[model samples]
Target chain A: MTERTATIASRVGLHARPAAIFAEAAADLPVEVTIARLGEPAEDALDAASILALMGLGAAQGDVVVLRAEGDGADAALESLVRILETDHDA
Target chain B: MHTYSGVGVTPGRVVGPVRVMPPAIAAPPAGEQREGTTTAEAAAGNLRSAAAVVKEELRGRAAKATGDGKAVLEATALMAADPMLLKSAVKLIDAGASAQRAIWEAGDGVAAMLLDLGGYMAERSHDVLDVRARIVAQLRGVPAPGIPDADAPFILVADDLAPADTATLDPAKVLALVTAGGGPQSHTAIIARNLGLPAVVAAAGVGELADGDEIFVDGGRGVVTTDPGDAEREAASRWAEQVSRLAGFDGVGRLADGHRIPLLANVGGAKDAVAAAAANAEGVGLLRTEFCFLGHDTEPGHDEQVAAYKGVFDAFPGKKVVVRTLDAGADKPLPFLTDATEPNPALGVRGFRTDGTSPGVLARQLAAIADAAGQSRADVWVMAPMIATADEAASFAALCTAAGLQTPGVMVEVPSAALTARHILDHAEFASLGTNDLTQYTMAADRQLGPLAALNDPWQPGVLALVQATVEGSRAQARHTGGPGRAPKPVGVCGESAADPALAVVLAGLGVTTLSMSARAIPAVSAVLRSVTAETAGSLARLAVSAPSAAEARSRVRARLPVLDELGL
Candidate 1:
């Protein structure tokens, strides 16, 4: 398994709509994302993109985040996430 | 002029000039530049210097204002410190726009940026946002909606209060606080009630209130109009006087025939307990211990719980305190109890039976209550909820006895508990009727379920039958234990039910030795009890229990009583 780093780019960052979009993207996939706060350890509680749970991570700008993908379309899954975060869907 | 209604937030009547906050003024346009200034940089410098002056003025005022006005300064100070706004302002200044334009544009940019960064309040507090909006308006020389004090007494009206802005207002000077917007949880509302300032928000056309106009504000009815006629003024004055009388009341529960029923305060935390104790309340009726254990990684240690209990107990030297052990795991959630699934949190495994399963949690909690009680002269009573069978009640009694706790009691909350109060009391020293939960369970309706809330009325015959049955069971137990005060010691009502003034009289009249409720509602309840004699109260309680409908129950009580002179009812 390889881990990649990405920033949240969609305008409605990791809240109600973003949580749904990100959950749908990860459903049934052999991948996991841990939303970490500016200075916190990643934990299993971040298994789902719950708006409140994600907020616990406290991710903000100029911050580093880790995404891990395993099995077959790992590359494709990681690439899709990068694009999702890079574009401001909230705009 | 438009007139909207809201809860009256502040009290009093004043007639004076209205001082609307000054509007933010914009600088000269680029096309109309001064003869000497050919470049946009010159215009930018002029605008920048002017903004500096306004910002400084804002800073100076925030430091000086009192009450809600002082809160505004605190919030304004924070808005003035926002990194995003400050950064944008710098950028606009670099781009050569006028000072006012730069400030306004910077604010707009920051709002747009944060709205895009959504999460669960990840953008920060609404109060912080309000501060930015007001500052920007001031920067542009636009009419800021801030209410002002014009030396003389006058009605103060506005759209809404920023927490900081509403904090500095003088309750006495303020004729009334009439605003266009707010909710039950709004800061203005909380502060108004906390400070005993009668105010009304959600009033329409409050801004249209011209200067030097005569207006009478009814805080209780949430009304503010231009000079109320004589009748209305008399009525409002009577109500105000009544409220003042009730607020000053400090009497204990007494029967017209001279019987005594202890009136106690229901406190949520040690701070509340201290405040109540200072008010000369008989003792704490319900000390919600959840405040000590909530938001923690593990269950609090015996020492920690004991410390908390001791603080509340120490506040009142000789007053009795009833400590209700852990009412959490339902309606209330503990940080570590996350995975405990609940289809409906309110009606589910809460009160006591649910938490009792963990002996370690129970034992430590029991020991803590016992220890706190030992330190004070006041007798500390230990109690639990949701105990239906004799076995459950006995187990709690055994635990409390084992831990040296006095008078381990059972709360008659569920229908099962009320139906078998005799059996439950066999193992306990006392019983307190929690009618709110009993009514919910008896009616088979979720009390918190808004759509079906009507079914949970305490006056419903089914609910009344359950309460009457519980009282009957208590009486039966008294007969078995050698009669009168010798039975299980004491019977009381300690819940939201205990807060109702009319209901307090009824409960005391029904032989309940004590009635406990929020400290704020205690004075009013005491006044109601004092007004009626014990003989009248007993019969009234019977009438209430016999009523078929909630409205009928209330009406019957009111028809028989003269009036609520002190409470202004």
Candidate 2:
């Protein structure tokens, strides 16, 4: 399994349009991607592909969140998603 | 011919075949469909087939949709075919439930979870519900529930229309709208008026009407007739044509005796401002500043505020623009500014009262308005909302002056402000009446409550007395300065009351110097104003004030203005 931490860059946080795009990206990956608050247990985290779960995080801009992925191509998938999380969709 | 009577919110006449929109689906039974249908294999197969069919339909719609609508449709499609959702449904199916019941239970679970999460997730609950309905319909081998495609223009009848449904409707294909539910102030009514479509709301037996039934709707008279005779159709057509011709007369509003009552438009945002300008509104009466602040997590900065205000101000150069400051309360809570919880937001800290806690927001907004005014040649006037005391009025005036904004005024939305209008006007430059809120506050009835709609009527004698008091207050102030009593300091009606032609006449008679309303309503109101002299309008106003109830006041005023009936108002 690979883990990554990134700050939410969207002005409106990980919700609305940005949340939709992020969830779709995770669903397209070959690995199982999960997301949770930084330093929290993975058991309490949610499937990264669930749009409602990602939006429920209430991760505002500049807030830190953790992402985890397992199985083949997990590392590559996590990096790509991290890049998306750090980019401002509003811009 | 069978007939039904309803409140016509927008006036026009049309005849067309009826198109009934299917109401929302009720929750399916939460158990197995039959005694022997408990096989997991059968349930899994059913779930897959149902999801696939719903997904394909959504994808087809997504392909045809464009712009923002495309994204929403595509998202719904993705949600319908979600692998997790399919797995969840299969789990229920394996637990001794039929395929339809399993799918229903799974969808309900997700919808409840989303709603429980609240905030942004809660908003998505509707999407889940809609997708579930589509899948359930597919499993049941029934047509999906929603609006149907129309090959031609038709009169749409529905229980009620959600904003999402209305956004996707093709206005050109809709002749008129009649609903079994909703009120005159409902979203359906507002959208119909904006689109120039005739609409009647709260029509009884509308749900009983069948598809393709020929019907005649006289929106002005709130009358709907089934299979109308030729004479009735011809009369309606003639009346509609006359009203259309009257709309084409875009001259300044005036009575037969040439009493000038500047006709303005109440614009909510920049787009409405453009439409109002196109309608040849002499100026803008109520430029609501709420759009700049609402829907934002944080207060908009000075630059953002400047750009927004400038967009509207630049549209109406050298035209009068009266803007009301931010009016937020429990009804419209902004977490960054207003308190998160309030027992009653309407009576809580809102409008000008917000200045106490969020002083920076008010100061920044005033500064931005001053900047916009400096850049544009429009005659900008600023006002504070919900001001009940002379001290608050004076303080608001001082703030505007400090920001270099002249012509500061107050809105008479509160009953106390209306009662002490002379004292309030003494400090402010002018005043505008917001009859909607004034009626709500005076009647002690929430405008949002449908059953209390009668009490919310502006025609109520009690409400009229408040309006009369405001006008008289302004006059007393004018007389106190030893100035002529005629045309005192520009008291205007910039509310829904000003939109009704008959009510507009009565308001004019009550010493209101200007009238402002939605741009589409300006033409009808202008037509009515041209027929009534100032003296006749005053008499109508007097009669309305003395009437016991709103219904009686309306009849009395209508009797005094017989030409209103002739014009189909």
Candidate 3:
């Protein structure tokens, strides 16, 4: 498994437009990815491709979250997802 | 014909077939076993297909939409196909739940989770429910719950509209809006106003209206007549003709004799100023400065304030722009300026009174206004709100002069200010009547309460009397200082009353020098003002002020002004 942590940068956090964008990106990747707030139990992780799950995570602006990916191109998927989380879509 | 009454938020008339928005989809019966499908796997497969169908339909709509609408639809589409949602539904199906019940309960669980997260996340729960409804409707072989599709123009009737429902509304096909629920400030009324669709809200029993039922909607009077006869149809046609004439207003306010009365707009920020300019407002009458102060925990710096003010000032080059100082407190309390624990905020320290608690804030604002004015060619006039005494006006004017700005004014919102306008004008250069506040203060009624709407009306005889007093005091001041031929200080009205065509005429007749209102109201006001002479307005004003009540005042003045009926006002 490839794992990464990134802080939410969108002013409104991982909801609405930013969540939709990240979910679309995650769904397009070859590797399956799951996300959970940092310090949350591993079992609490949710499918990163689901906008509903991302919104349900309640990740606000400046919150750090952990992303884990598996299978082919896992590392590349984690890197791209981390970049999306760090970028301020609002700006 | 059965007639339903509601509060009218906009003015116009129309008759068309009704298009009732479909009610929300009912939740599926709980604990029902899977039908037709032989196994749990078959039930789960059915759920997946239903979700896919909903996702595809949403994706189709998202492809055609743009901007925020497109973003919302795309997000909803993603929710429809969310794997986690399907997994939960499938889990339920394995536990002996039917496909319909499984998906419904699964959707609720997700929505409840989002709701538990609270704040912005809680708002998204509604979107989940909306998507769930669509999927459920698809599975049930029923029409989706939302705005119904129609081929031609129709009057839309709904219990109330959700913000998402209004997003897909095609304004061209909506002739008018009538809702059984919601008030004048509801989402439906506001959107109706923006789309220029006549709307009546809080109309009881309007939900009973059926599809394709002919209805006559008189938004000006907040009346909905069912199965209207030829007379109502003729009136609707006449109103349509009058509305087209109103569109031709040349952006100038004048009387029949060509006496000019400048029509200005009340704007909140630079964006509103741009729209006001596009609407050809002679200038801004009330540029509310609270936008800079409302959201900040600490006061905005001098440069930030200057930049914000300059944006508005730049929009009306070489034209008058009257800016009201930060009127914080009472209903618009600011943490940095007001004591939230005050027993009576309305009667407590507010508006100009806030300066006493937070010194230098008003001074800094004045300096910023002067700085912005120096950079722009706009004729900037500064004013303070909630001034109850001549001394407050003098002190406020002194601050303006100290900041190197001229043309300091005071808003005549308090009864005392109107009573002592002659003295207040002794120090202030101009006085603008805020009729909404003046009426509230005069009648001792809370303006925000719906029940007090009658007493809070600007047409109340007591309120009109105070307006006359302020105008008379201004004239008296002019005579005292510059003799009989001198003009009174330029007193304008920047209030909701100024937007009413009939009331605008009465205000002009009462010696008000200018009328300022929302940008959308300028055309109708300008058109109506051009239909009456100064002499006629004076008589109408007299009739209004001498009337016993607000209703009587309105009827008396409206009866004398034949142009109102001619224009379907």
Clashing pairs in 3: none
At residue B537, give the lDDT of candidate 3: 92
Segments of candidate 3 deviating more than 4 angstroms: A7-13, A37-41, A52-64, B5-9, B23-65, B76-149, B160-169, B181-190, B201-203, B257-259, B266-279, B286-315, B323-374, B381-491
lDDT of 2 by residue, B1-569 (tens): 89998777777778889999876666767675534734688668877888888878888887878866777777787778666677788887777777777777877888787767664455566787889888888877766777767898999998777667764678889989998776665567667777868888777788889999999988876778899899778867887677666575474988868999999988888999998998899999999898887656678889889889988998899989998988887456665677645678888898999999888788789999999999998999999999999999999999999999989999999999999998998889899999878988998877655446567778889988999999889889888875774556778999878888888999999989999888889988988888888999999999999998988988888887777777777
Q: Could you tell me the lDDT of residue B335 within candidate 2?
A: 55
Q: What TM-score does chain B of candidate 3 reach?
A: 0.73
Q: What are the lDDT figures for the candidates, one per model?
A: 0.62, 0.83, 0.87
State the fnat of model 1. 0.00
**What is the lDDT for B169 in model 1?**
67
Q: Could you give the CAPRI-style class of model 2?
A: acceptable
lDDT of each residue in B138-240, candidate 1, tens digit only: 5455654455645665556655565445445666666556665553224555455445555676565566665665566666446676655676567666765
Per-residue C-alpha lDDT of model 3 across residues B326-376, encoded as one tens digit per residue: 998876767678876689898988999988988999999999999999999
Candidate 1 runs further than 4 Å off: A1-91, B1-229, B249-251, B338-341, B354-359, B443-462, B483-488, B565-567
* DockQ values per model: 0.02, 0.37, 0.64
